[model samples]
Target: MAALNLTPSDTSTFMLMGIPGLEAAHIWISIPFSMFYMISLLGNFMVLFVVGKEQTLHQPMYLLICMLALTDIGTSTSIVPKALCIFWLNLKGITVCACLTQMFLLHTVTAMHSAILVTMAFDRYIAICNPLRYATVLTNVRIAKLGLVGLIRAILFVLPLPLLLTRLPFCANRIILHNPFCDHMAVLKLSCGDTTFDGIYGLVVSFIIIGSDLMLIALSYGLIIRAVLRISSKTAHQKPLNTCTAHICVILISYTPFLFTALTYRFGQGIAPHVHIILADLNFLVPPMLNPIIYGVKTKELRDKVGKYTSRR
Candidate 1:
């Protein structure tokens, strides 16, 4: 156990526990982790590039997708690079400032990802519930404003986290993190001083930011379902419902791992440490890798554009 030192030290750094109890397998493990990183980068960048170049994709839904692609890139980029450095170069030490930056970026981007999903649900709601006014409701300027709001919301809510952490003194005894990347709760747990406020704030932020977004998304879908139910024509109902499949799939892939890991952290008493670490890592990795694939396969416009771009190259 480490003791708390409130004063700043000349040499202070946290050692990352890259797959604890599996140090020997770090080199081999890097292979798949690196593959996921590469694929996430390539896939998300392709979405951004293709959406930008293709004029036909300049619609509200795809525009929201562009926002999703950007958020995925931000979220994955925050974690994977440092993880690869740890695996390849055996560099497990991260400075205090760098660790705080990582935590901020990762959490903020995650909140933004959730926020974007809410907006996408709203987009779908309009398209299905009120198709005739979808254009008027979600205009280019309005879409941009919505994206800004999501970004601002994430930044505002997550801003206090680091400041709060900075006030606490870290234990000099042992700063080894069990996870590959820096997470809010993981870092707070290492502090030697009082962390009750930090923990409470963390829970409050998660609930207020992500919890509210989840409710709004559910409400949007509920309204959408009710509207669809009213449609007597089976073909008409199916058409609008099909438009939401991609977004729904993206939501599931993004949230399921996150919620599972969170629950395990809170309630899992007998779980192995490595399992917790792996889930935390995957919570960041899986969504970015799958978002593009899901959208490309389920969305006709994105699929056609991707095919067209790849064929030309």
Candidate 2:
């Protein structure tokens, strides 16, 4: 890699890569990617539209669903369109500022999505374990506050990432990123400067945010499980557990690919670059496409409303 003097300027641009080994199949590869993006948009938008139109669905749980839907839309929009452009049109030149902005939006929206999941877990816990105080605990104002806090927390944690990247002088000859989007680690690797602090900060922030949120969600479910088990009636246990099924599915889909990709990056050096890139892409792609579908299948009210709308259409 030849070193060239480059700073974060308008002329500095990074070339985004599609699947490294599958460059020949970029067009073929985009078929499903495009489908997933479209499905994510349509499904999440339908969720928001349904929630908005039906006054009866304006409860804490549905409101949280709306939040998740918005974040899902954000997550998909932040990355997929650019990815599709690279895949289909071969338009891969992204300026340093644009790449940094994309990186920031990608991470912030992801953090917000994780927080929404935590909020949903809390919602389930309250509805099941503290049924009497559910309404009092999670009013519309409170939900709005929670969403605001999630946004602020996301911005606070992710705001420094682009700033950190800006300080690192990138190798002028090595501006081609091997992934579809401007990922934090991918961008960090391009920097010629000592990235020890930046890398450590990124990891620490990720652990603190993801680890703490996971723990909170686990604790919430643990309590919910304990509360359900204390019930004397076996038949009564099903309803509470059923409500959580959709959320659990969402959590698995949202986190599983992310954890797998993170672990692969640290441990799986032999993994193909294309494979890693695909997994990384799927981390952002899969959840938004599946979340609403899972909820529609598992949630009766949402399913009924969707059915009514489709039948009428």
Candidate 3:
């Protein structure tokens, strides 16, 4: 095999394969992707608008929703534009520095999204289990602090990832990324130097960030279930449980594909390249496209406010 580059540098440009082995269908693929990206943008923007303008929504739960919306926007915006460019415009080449930048933004926003979900779980836990102290426990100050924690955690952990990858040497015949977007693993796989450390570091970070978030979210729901069970009237239990439905849907949408993609990357050696790429895209794209719809429909107050907001505009 011919070497692609002598060393990883700012001058190095990598080709982005919109969807490997499916080049003939790229035009058709772009249609759905463009639709999703547009919808994700509009939907998330609506959530932000409704949340920001509606004073009644100035609570912890809605605030967390706003955070989630922002995370979705950030994650999708970072990838979808470039992916679309690759698919529609056939502008596939991206500089090493640019690729790393996209990777950093995508991964950091993803980590932040996970952290936000954990915080939302905590919010629901307090709301359902200790209704009396819900407001007191999740005051604006505390919520702001939690947001800060999410940001700091994402910055600290994901910051080193691109930096590490930048240090690696490239020896492939051509720097062709199999995925439309600059995914961390997809990019790392092209390196000539030892990539074992990158893989391990990614796994460690995933376990620490996503695994812990999932565990805590599960724990929160467990406590919530126990509390709900204590209520004698089914009506009373349903009232509290209903409040968590939207969040649960959002969590499932966000985590399931993410976990599937990460697992397939690590363990699914026999899996098709296109399948892995699809799962990876879905992990980022589907959540953004679905989250706002789920929230808009499942949340009565947000739904009503959104209706009123749209009517006026």
Candidate closest to the true structure, highest lDDT: 2
Clashes of 2: 0
Could you tell me the TM-score of candidate 1?
0.95
**Residues 3-72, model 2: lDDT tens digits:** 1233323257887777788988999899999999999999999999998999999988999999999999
Candidate 3 local lDDT, 212-310, one digit each (tens): 999999999999999999889988888888889999999989888877776787899999898887787777788999999998999999999999978
Error of 3 at 184 (Å): 1.5
Instruction: Name the lDDT value of residue 32 in candidate 3.
Output: 82
Q: Can you give the TM-score per candidate against the true fold?
A: 0.95, 0.95, 0.93
User: What is candidate 1's lDDT per residue for 120-165, written digit by digit as tens?
Assistant: 9999999888889988999978988999998998899998999899
- Give lDDT per model, in order: 0.87, 0.89, 0.86
Worst 10 residues of 2 by lDDT: 1-10
Question: Candidate 3 has which clashing residue pairs, if any?
Answer: none
